[model samples]
Target chain A: MEKKTRVLLFKPGLDGHWRGIMTVSKALSEAGMETIFFGFKTVEGVVEAAIQEDVDVIGFSVHSGAHLEWARELVRELEEKGARGDFLLLVGGVFPEQDHEELREIGIDGVFGPGTVTAEIVRFIEENLGRKVSG
Target chain B: MEEMEEIRRGLEEWREAKKGWPERREEFRTDAGIPVKDLYTPLDMEGIDYLGDIGFPGQPPYTRGVYPTMYRGRYWTIRMFSGHGTPEETNDRWRLLYEEGETGFSAAVDSLTFSGVDPDQEVHGAAHEVGKEGVPLYSIRGVEALVENLPIDRMSVALVVEPMTSAAVTSMYFNVAKERGLRKEQLAGTTQNDILTMTIGYIPWGSLKPADLLKLACDLIEYCTAMGEAPRWNPINFTTYNYREGGIDAVQEIGMGLANAVAHIEELLRRGWKIDDFVHRLAFHLSAHRDFFEEIAKYRAARKLWYRLMKERYKPENPDAYRFRFHVQTAGSSLTAQQPMVNIIRTAYQALEAVLGGTQSLHTNSYDEAICLPSEESVRLAVRTQELIQEETGVANVVDPLAGSYYVEALTRELEERIWDYFMRIEEMGGVVEALNTGWLFNEMSKAFNKRRRDQECGAERVIGVNCYVMEEEEPTPPFRTNPRAAEIEKERLRALRAERDNRRVAALLDRLRGVCERRENVLPVVSELTAAGATLGEITGVYREVWGIWQLPFVA
Candidate 1:
């Protein structure tokens, strides 16, 4: 049997809107991924969870229009931890369509905004898993 | 008999029209799981008494509307939910919205406010929290700045806050009102005092536990009841918006809202407040979801069910007690960042549904909100969305335009029955507080959410931009730049306020609040006095934090 992919979903901001992440987590579970929701964590918290959970994917969702600052800080946090590019790093929630490329430059692996189908997300994770192992 | 024969012949024609329409691939149920038949006819609404089930506007059941002239008498208040960065920034948004002909002010306080922590106390270096989500209000002075220079008498101010902070936020308002020479009775505002919303595990913790929050909610309601006959003082807007957005369908939203309302009513009744005294002021913050008919029928059925429930069960003497006056906001969950411009159409339709469903007020989400906190241009455009509907479209000429439609009426009836079934299930768990605590309520929400997820995954549902319609390569929408220094500015203000305030006096007032808490007396009036005496929001909320410590959702987290 193939090993199940473990994904840690972190709400990396204080925005109390949870529908996006909750829905995505549900989708990941339905797609047969092992999911952990680190409810409302800091960037450091996200990086720490990546180490602790030994997960294949880490997705941060920031909806308060502060994703630029949050994403930068998370990249810095990962670099400081010497774990940059160790896992598949994804970002979601209320981001402009134009920022997907900039997100990749800033060390994010994939960008999933609102209305991106969960099935597509599952596929993204599946496709990205080998990259994490090879890296 | 002739009309029946004409309907039967029309039904045959409808069936013929629907034959081979190529819609087999579609899901056949509302989000509530009620099957959507190909055609609804007189047979669908078999025994619904028009007058009894769908009452006239302003009459029993109130299926049509709460007011005789819903928008014609005047329009529903065009409210845009606004708060971000500093109180100064939020105040700027308020001024702009008010100047742009928005009618009401809804305050969205920051996350620290929800936890009863002052910015200085807890969030010093938290980059994301510096008014990123909402204004960081920590004291009487904080709220004072938030509402500074507003025409208090002309506009109804609604605090879109939670339970534990109700007393603190209300005190901030009362103190400001006193400073402005306004009496308690002269105030008109609402506090989103539904702790049941908190228990849905949306937020990890509120400042207080479930039981404490309920007592505080009852206290605020009773405080408003005692305040002399000043109309429009909405004490509580029982919210199922967050719950529904959390994945529950329309039926559960109505049912949970009804159950939470009754739970408050029961508590207030036990405290010896007449149901008529406070029930008139009860309201709802209902979500306008994507299903146009389901959303419309949900609002209609909510009002009718509440009326019958209040009349038959509690028996309030005032007719106003039965009317479920709700403020609707477009479902934030329905917005999409892909082709973000399409969200404007989604919001317009949702706003129209709210207007047609006879909402007392409505808040339309901005097109770019799926990307961030609404930019100024987007918010202005959102405000314009409502104006276009109100001015351009003649939707408001008649009240409840879809009142007699066989499909709408059938949906409304089926929704009402299912809502009652939900109510019974809720009651079986001893009531809302127990249901929420025992994970029973979350279980229901989980089921609702899981069903929705399955539907989305299996292509049973189409979210336009999300599932079926492919925006192969999305154009780059404008990026939103957040104020990184908002935290420092807000904290500096807090520091200056703390320095200016008389510490000994503030401590004494908080001690008095603690005494009031111990005596089990009503907490609002005492806190109002302290706020008027120049105490901070953090100090007032600290009393609660001290009393309750911090509440944790052991089941989910």
Candidate 2:
């Protein structure tokens, strides 16, 4: 039996937009990933859940302009705590096109913009996981 | 023999196609959360009435439109949601929009002013978000700067105001009109004074308990109607779009919206006012979402349901009272923040749906709405998108263009059945306000909203950026950057107003307002007085909060 890909999904702000995050969570689960959703968590709450869940991938979905700052802080915290290697950092939301390179430099492996298909995200995770599963 | 045949079929298909299912598979869900089958036929509709349900445009029930000629007679008003930072800035933008051929203005105020707080108030905090999301006007002086040199008589204005302390803002506009000597009848526009919709979305400013909110709402309705702002001052907009963005599907949005309307109508009728007197000015602000067919069906169902509810439930003698006319805002939630540019395409689709759904007026979400406030460049594109649809598409040439189509007609009926069923559920839950108070409505929206995320995560639904079409390297358009000093400019305007204006009269008018609100008396007349006295938005809201006691809901994620 193959072990499931454990994924944690969360929104990092009080902003009430749940549609994008909800759709992405559903897609991940249907792609055979085990998912736990932390609804609208604070910065501290998200980092705590990351440590507790010890998931393969941690995704933070937010539209507020705090993504770059949050990612940098999270990466710094993870590096200090020696948990940086365990999780692949994936970030998505109204990221300005110009900030894509800057976000990558902060340890985000994948960035999804509008017009992206679900299959591509699934493929990104599968490739990142390095576990080839044939259905 | 049967087993052998199945094996052979499977083998042949596997050989021909590497994957068993179609190569590009995606799950499609309606805006109403209805699962769409491969095809829908005439059998789906079963029974539908064209004349009774849709009718000729500009006729009874108004399923198509309230006007006979719709866009053919006159185009839907291109009302840009303006007003951000300060009065002067908003006025400059308004003048530019008008010059660019916008027919009307829709003002979005900052949280402080919208909630009825003065710019200098401690409640505003250091981070004054004025002009960031909406225009922050402190007094009639601010209003003057916002609408300076504009043709108040010729151009229609829609102020996106919640009734927390809106009397001052509204009164200021009226005072300006009066100041310019424009006839009350010549002034045409809407004040989005819907306290219910504002309350539901969890605005942190001054809110009211259900009872007080209802009273304030009634006060505004009565004030506007009796003050003879008959054609203008659209005090009621049963806004369900907020619910939809919160995660309630189309059916729930419409069902709850109607229920909300029912509560208001019941309150007014109980007060001994005839329904016909107030129902005409009542309009709906609906969400024109991306789901093309579902949105169209939702509109059609809303018309049929509202007409039946008025005729059968209320039994109003006036024909016009039975008609349901509404303005549509393209779904802001549907636009992705990820692929920002693609939002334009998404907005176009939603706009097309609005046209097909038959909206009275439409406001397309600017492509950059998800990231920041729209710039003039983007706002123009949004308006031009609509203008293209009107002038070039030839879509508005006919009435209910898809009225009798098999797919559209069937979808319309299924939607109606589901909505009526949902309406019964709401009624069972003790109507709109009760359900809202109990968090039933919030829960429903949250559940669906969360489910959609789960589906996207599991590949059941495909959102272009988050789930599919992974972009390894790309550039997102630079968001329209606003001057960070917008709030400073607005604060200066407020400071200037304090130096000006009648201090003694303003104090007296504010006291009068407090007296009426405390007594639960008709406060509109006093509101007019307060505005005339140059009482600020914050002052009016402060008085209201002291009386009504702001609503503190158990916060929901």
Candidate 3:
């Protein structure tokens, strides 16, 4: 039997556009993943929830262009706490294509912008977790 | 018999060959929650009567339009929605848009100011908000700053405000006009005093108690109705569009909107106000989404429904009260941040749809809406989209061009039935207020939203820039960038305005305003007094908070 992948999804700013986050949460839950939604969190708030929840991966669903700096800042926080390389970080929303390379360098393993398939997001996380189990 | 059997066997083989070639069938539904049929024939509209359901344009129960020549005589007003940073910035943009052929102004205030506060307040900066959402207004001065270069007397302004603090905003605009030596009779504009829906969605922001909100809304309606003829106050805005953006299908949008209209009418009738006195100023703010045919039908059905409800149910004597006048704003959610230019095309299509649907006025979304505040270039393009439809398309030559078409009439009737079902369902649940309180509407929206997302993931629906026709190498930088100093600039402006004004006058007016709010007197006159006295928005709102208290949002957010 395959173990369920626990994913903590959150919004990092005061922005209240929750349609994207809510829809994704529904998708992950339907796909049999234990999706914990920490609705509208600050960077520090998200970091604290990650530790408290002890999840397999963290995904930031942001639309307000502050995702680039936020992603970089969260990665640094994870590294300092020795949580880096242990869990995967995923980013989604209306991110421009150019920011993809920079986000990856900051320890982000995946980038899902407009037109992103929820199944693709689920598959990526599941396969990476599967690799860990097999290795 | 042998030859016939041989032919049947060959046909069976042909049928088997086609078995797995096509994708799964998809369901099509309007945003109003109406399930759309694949085809509509005369059979579908068998019960509908041409003279009764959809009569000539400008007639009672106007399914076609509120006017005889709708677009033929005058095209729908190109009402551009523009507000950001400071009043100065917003005002400058308004001038630019007008120069680019925009026919009217639709103001978008910052969230802080919209909630009735000064830009320099503590809540403004912590939200990382500032001019990110809209222009920050403080008092009559901010209103003055917004219309400095623009012609106030010449233009029609639509203040997108809820009833809670609309009196104060409208009073400030009136005060600005008074200063400009323009008569109240000369002011041509609309203020969205739709109080019912303010509490219907987003539990955090609406008037907490229905009775109190209704009282304030009634006061505005009464005040505007008495102002005599220049038609300054647009007291009621049936915001079906807001719900549409939040994922409610079209039928629910119309149904809930009509339910809200019913709520307003019931309140007014209970208060002994004549129906004709208050209904004329009522206007609708509709969303023009991507669905071309369905959208047109939705508008047609809305007009007919409103007209019939007013005439048959209320029996309002005035012909004007029975007409459904509305403004259309293109859907922002349909626009993608990726391949932002494609939004221009999307906006143009929606704009054309609005005109064909017989909108009184229209606001086409800027291409940059998915990302940030629209730059001047993008704003101009949005305005031009409306102008192009008016000048080039020749679509404006008739009113409701698709009215008599069998497909359109059938679709319109189907849409009417679906919306009526929603209205009935909500009424059974103890009206829109109770439905909103219990999260029934939100649940419906979430369910539909999930299905739509599933379709996108399963490749049932195609969003060109989002799910299909994506470009991997294209890196087009957006033209607009929000100034981080917007908060600071607004703060300085607020401080200076406060320092320069008469301190005693501000204090006296605010104290008087607090007294009136607590005494159950109509707060409009008091708010107007405070605005004229040069009191800040924060001061006015603080007084109301002391009297009425802030709403505690019901949701878990």
Candidate 4:
């Protein structure tokens, strides 16, 4: 039996925009990935959960324009736990195109902004994880 | 009747003649999936009586306009919803908009404020979001700074907060007004105390139960309008605009709004209030979306339906209760991030729809909003978009200018019936509160979200920059970043407030609030005093959460 790629997604902090994250979760699940959507969690909590769940990818969405702050916090949390290189970290939400490089520099593997296609996200996950997800 | 018969015969010949000409698509439909015909004539409006169905403005069945003169008497207030970084920065932005001819002000609060958490709270990473989404009004000091040196006494202000913190936040503003030597009777503003906004639209953290939210919402209406505390203030605005931005169409938008309004009305009436007490001050905030004619017809249908609902059901003796006055905002969901300049043209056309629909107020979205908060230049352009419609365009000169158009009138009648049917479906499911508890409203929102995603992906709904006319290698628009020290500044403000205010007094008032919550009485009077005594929103909402308990949403991913 093929081991399904596990992905953990959440919303960091108190930002309440849920549609984008929920859509991505459903898309990844339909794409044959085991998605665990922890609705709202702290970066530290998400990192601990991802490590415990043995997820291949950890993703979070932010629409509160604090994307840089959140991205940095998540990376710091992962580094502090010695799990920075363990999972593919992804950040997606309503942020500026100019901030994509800064987000990537903050140790995020995937950065999806506004008008992102769900298929593009699935492809990014599959390609980066070194496995073809059969949907 | 003879004219209708002749037009019916003419429509049959025209339909046959049009069969030879190739149409643009196999089918034509409005954004709401209502089938559209190639042409409409008097036959389409045969049963719609002008006097009974489409009466003149300021009369029953206000299909034309809410007021008799409409924009001819005065232009719709250009009330922009804006806030960022800090209350001081937001006040500066308000001054800029006012200088640029904005008539009203709306405060958009940050996530911490929205969720009733202060920046200094121990909640996870709460400081990161302080003053990020909007201005942080945690205490009365922030509220005072937000309206400092502004003519709030004359111009109306809107506090875009939900029921969770509406009582506390609104009271903060009211207290600010009072200290500035203004009476509550002379104050005019709106509180976006819509229950569905938190439950469905944005889904704030630690939200109260649907029934408890209803109690909080009705508490405000009972305080301001029914109790005559702030007689001129609009205590609650049923903001369907927030919900519509989640991808619902025109029919679902108005349908949900009507059902939501009914929930509040029933709650207030149950609390021993007359129909005329609060219904007249019940305003709406609707969206102006892509469908030009359909959006126009939607405003008309909404006015008529509100009139019909009031006349047939509540029958408030106050004539103003039947008027469905609304503020229209150009659809934020319709704007695309790619080729952002095109959003300007899109906003212009939607603004025109609102003007033709006879909106009482309007807010045009900035072109760069799809990406980040609007820059000063971009927001200025957004204000100019509405200014162009009022100044350059002659559309607002006449009231409901398209009132007699065959397609518009027919579509209005069609939409009125469809909206009523959808509203009844909600009513059948035990109204808005029950539907919310059963997760039925969330299901509707999720369904709409998926459908819109699918439609856009498959090119069924062609967004100019996203799907069609794609632009590659475009220069990124310069993003407007909020103040980096906003969190630190807001935390300092809270710290200072705590040191200065009489802690004993605040604690005693909080105890009173807990008792009020236990008795399920109105929380306004005590909350007003608490805000004056420098109590934070987190403290006030904390009491409610402790007493009522937080709601666990029946949400599934």
Comparing 2 and 3 on DockQ, the stronger one? 3
Backbone clash total for model 2 is: 43
- Any runs in candidate 2 off by more than 4 Å, and if so which? A1-135, B1-29, B35-37, B124-126, B555-557
Q: Tens digits of per-residue lDDT for model 1 on B454-509?
A: 77767776777767785674555675555668778877877887798787887888
Clashing pairs in 4: none
Q: Score the docking of each candidate (DockQ).
A: 0.42, 0.12, 0.19, 0.84
Q: Which candidate leads in lDDT? A: 4
Q: How well does candidate 1 match the true structure, expressed as C-alpha RMSD?
A: 3.2
lDDT string, candidate 3, A59-85, tens digits: 887655556666887888787777787
Candidate 1 chain B weakest ten by summed lDDT? B119-128
The Cα local distance difference test for each model comes to: 0.79, 0.73, 0.75, 0.92
Which of the numbered candidates is closest to the native, going by highest DockQ?
4
Residue B228's lDDT in candidate 4:
95
Error of 2 at B283 (Å): 0.5
lDDT of 3: 0.75
Task: Flag the better candidate by lDDT, 1 or 4.
Answer: 4
- Chain B TM-score of model 4, please? 0.99
Residue A129 shift from truth in candidate 1, angstroms: 3.6
Candidate 4: stretches off by over 4 Å = B1-6
* Fnat (0 to 1) per candidate: 0.50, 0.15, 0.13, 0.85
